[model samples]
Target: MKTYLIATLAMAASAVAQPQKAETPSPEPSRPQMRAEQPAAPKPSRGAFDAMLYVSVQDPSMEWWFNVPEGFAPHISEIKKIFHNQEFSLFPFADNAKVKEGKFSISYSISMKSPDGSLTELVRGAKYEGTKVADDIMVACPDVIDFKLDGRFPEGLYKFFISAKDGISGEISEYENHIRLAEWSAPVPFTGKKLVSDYVRAFSLQPSPEALYSIVFSDDFDLEQKGAPNSLNYTYLGFMKAAFKKNMFLISHIRDSFKSLSDLNRAKFILILAILGEKGIDASALSEPEKRYQEQIRAFKLPDPYGKWDPFLGAAQIDMLWGEFFADGTYRPVRRILNILSHAKEAAFADELAEKSRAPKTQAEWDRYMLGRLYKAALKTVAINARKYPLVEQYCAWALLHGDIPEVSYEVLSPMLEHIREMKSPSGGESGENPKVRMPRIDVESL
Candidate 1:
């Protein structure tokens, strides 16, 4: 029994020492796995913008003679009395929100819809790139839009639209306005007397230079009439000033228009030429006008004795011609000036004028007296032949004696004097005497 129990225990130990087979996990229904959630990305910012419109008008209070009212409250819904061939201006503004780095851009398009439902693109995709914000705000606009109502557009209501875009933030703004063109009317026929009266009235009303210009150059207006020359003298100076301030190009057209006038209207045309020279129009452009003036004055045949012609008119003519001569270095204008002086001297009016100059009653008389004094001064000065002296040098000598030099002429004279001083003599000397020394020196105070 002891041996059987030992064998049974050994059998049990051998069974325990032997390795047992591992049990495998059974697959019951396969399950899917879950992933961790991620946060969302941010959105881009949108900018703000607004639109504005302005009607540009001529206001002395503003620079460049134009006033563009700011803000949207004063926008015009209907433009009135838009006459044919009359120009008008509109300013479209883009009030944009400031962007990063103050960097922004603007693009605009303008269109006009006519009464017939036809659209005319006045401005297409006008773009201003790299525009910076001013005063922490970006109020951008393209150039002023100017248009005239002509035969192309019949008198009717027209719609104007402006589309502006901000390139930086992709913002767009739009604006619309309307204008009613007036019916076309024929200009009234004006006689010389009526024309002069109307022109004088226009000055007080402060009508645009364009309106006054139309009246002055009207087809029905007479260029030759009683007091016509004097009337121009009294009013044209003011007209020219206004026109020059408003538009410099108009002055050129006005000067050239003299070419169209009839030579029979001698006195009036002469006055026009004089006014142009005084107003500082380019002398080169006036060459043809000056020629016409010379021809007309010669045909005028001044009465043999100086007194035969109206003294006021004659003196006025001389005064006007003097202005031309002073402005022009050419010989033609000065030739006429000398001719009139010689005639008055021959007629012995100089002494009488000197006496009357002391006590002048009218503006015309005062002008005549001044001419007399100028003539007397010319008489006392030594004569310089045009052939002998260079044109600029002759003018310089005259200006020195007159005690005043016009800025325009001085610009040319100053450089010339310097060049003369630097010039080497024909003998190759280091120093040379100024040619001006040959001309007689007159004390302007004595004159």
Candidate 2:
């Protein structure tokens, strides 16, 4: 009985020991093996984001930038004008945005759309708009779908849309751009077409080619042609101040530049002679004082004393070339050269020469006067042979389409023979007299 009890107690003890020992059964290799077979768990997706937004005129001379969530790269590609569905593709810049990590920097240059309404590929001096960098939170990062719009878009609806990719699931999440553009007064003043017309009307009384030429030569000139925002150049207020100064200068120099003030009063003398010469007036037709002047003119042939004037713009051309043609009177030599060109029988050749003969004058007055003469002479020459050459008339019409000037009568114009005669050569070298012009001074330090 004692032996039986001891054995039983030993068995109980063994069972108790087994329970307390905590059986570590060959440390299940299953868990480690399963872990080795499984792939990595994906990263978590970011939560929804919302931000502010706004839209404004885009400047072609600038690079625009936008900030977006890293996963929204696919959505940004959609925003591009040339969108292509591909992962990790670069976005095309619409405006002149120099994109660096989706950051923007702009350049100073004019850009205009071509005739077909496509953007000009290169920078120009006559079509750029002013640039502004927006540091506002909305402008900086517009990737959020719940973005609130700033500024009122009065004329049209302002819209935005966004899409993002789920990093872990590789699923796309679309967002309707909730931001709407609000219409707000621009910080910069707006100068419209009406203002420009008003300015032209107010100061057009005593015409100066300088004013007109300045308008055409402006760096932002192309915008004016396309009816773009005039504010792109400068404020109307700023323009008015400069115009006032130009107006004063034009008024002061009207007599010297527009009226007959240069050339020893020879231009006026020629004018009187041409008027008389057209009426077939001779030496005997003049009164006592006029006769003396006529005698001097006849002896001097003062219209073109140097023969250089005659060969290019001979006797007949000199007689009919309007005195107003040379507003400064010093450009008579150039006028004569142009007259010789007008006599060319081939209208195409004549126009080609005229296009090539751009005057080398920086002053608006000089350039305008020369261009005006060229325009007029070209028109008159075409009109002279209107019946035989219809294309000449069409060319003249095209030239007149873009400009306004006094109407000319073909009956009053000089004959072709006279035009030919004026294009003759003189005996010898002419006198050395430089016309008034501003020459560039070299900066020695630059060299």
Candidate 3:
């Protein structure tokens, strides 16, 4: 079967050490004004539901206009109700204290059931400064206040409305759905390899990360050698990169298509592969996250040429990649890799390049066929971790079938396969060191 894989880039954001398959970043522009034009935001899709809301808390001392009007105060509980799990503190009212005037930036972030939710709208507030006059809250309406949700949110684009009190006065105020309340959700549970396979087949996408690895181990491979040199040459960075990248797709599919299976199947499979691949590599390795961190360090050769604390930046990058990927499905790394693999000839490259190209590794590697091997490794990793990670196995099987590859075998790796078959827990849970895992190595020798 043509293996569909989410080939991970390095874990470290500043992976200066990874063997330089690409060239140095372009030189900084000489003119300051020329560089002043910051990078442009990704173009929104045609006919996409990209909504924005701005919230300005007017002064309590005055008419006390809120982002919403006084009539809608009853719904305040409903609005705040949705954000129960969020680490938010309700700013208490000081009797007659002045309302602080500032723009509350909230990003309306949308994602699929998977970690990689697809779209993020910057909900910007108008130039909101505290106005000493009554109805000062009017300034808040000019733009939207932005609060961004990081993970899977409830299934709906945030809705906006306004309600006001009927009194001697006109509408005291109005409250738009200024604060978008939504959560990021992981994929739901499903059972039976055949059933799961059928789901994937019907969907034409990968499963959740937790699902794929859970199943891959059932086939065959040596878990003991998972991270050993070229037995898989698997690194923590690779897994993280995959998760981060797939999230972009996951998030986009849900946001764009109303969480329709038909729209998200492809994205779902990719997310499952990327996440489970990371879990499998982590589960099989003895040192785990730390070991992975070290591998990235060795590969990239930390500090100096890469910059000080490149390893930290790299780790941050992994997390950040996940955040961005989950926030929107248009991140650069994963999409670029997927684009190449999707379009590349089946058996293109015969050997690694003898002469280096000045292109970046992402662009340079596009011409090479190593992506195929990387995809295979990602697949294998998912399988190996399936036993230890049910979510990984389930999702992998789901993704494989979705992609039209039926009946995968371990090729039979290690006892991990058997362990997965007999494993108990299906509810995917997060496992790994909290703060620090081993670092990864980047090969920056050529740089």
* Top candidate (TM-score): 1
* Candidate 1 global TM-score: 0.35
The number of the candidate with the highest lDDT is 1
Give per-residue CA lDDT, model 1, range 372-406, as digits (tens). Answer: 65554333321332223344244333333232333
Q: Deviation in angstroms for 120 in model 2?
A: 55
Q: Of the pair 1 and 3, which is ahead by lDDT? A: 1
Write down the TM-score of every candidate: 0.35, 0.15, 0.22
* Candidate 3 residue-wise lDDT at 443: 24
Model 1 scores a C-alpha lDDT of 0.41
- Ordered list by TM-score, greatest first: 1, 3, 2
Least accurate 10 contiguous residues by lDDT in model 3: 88-97
Question: For model 3, how does the per-residue alpha-carbon lDDT over 1-447 read when each residue is reduced to its tens digit?
Answer: 221111111122121111111122211112111112455334334322122222222111111112111212101111222231232111111011122241121111211121234332222121212222221111212221222233434534343332222121122222233233444344445546565434322221232333322322222211223434333312222333433343333333333433344322323333333443322123232234434543453354211211221222323222232222222222232222222223223122412232343332664354343443443433344344444433334433322222312122212122233432322222222222212212222222211
Error of 2 at 1 (Å): 99
Error of 2 at 265 (Å): 45
User: What's the lDDT for all of these models?
Assistant: 0.41, 0.26, 0.27
Q: Model 3: how far is 67 from its true place, Å?
A: 32
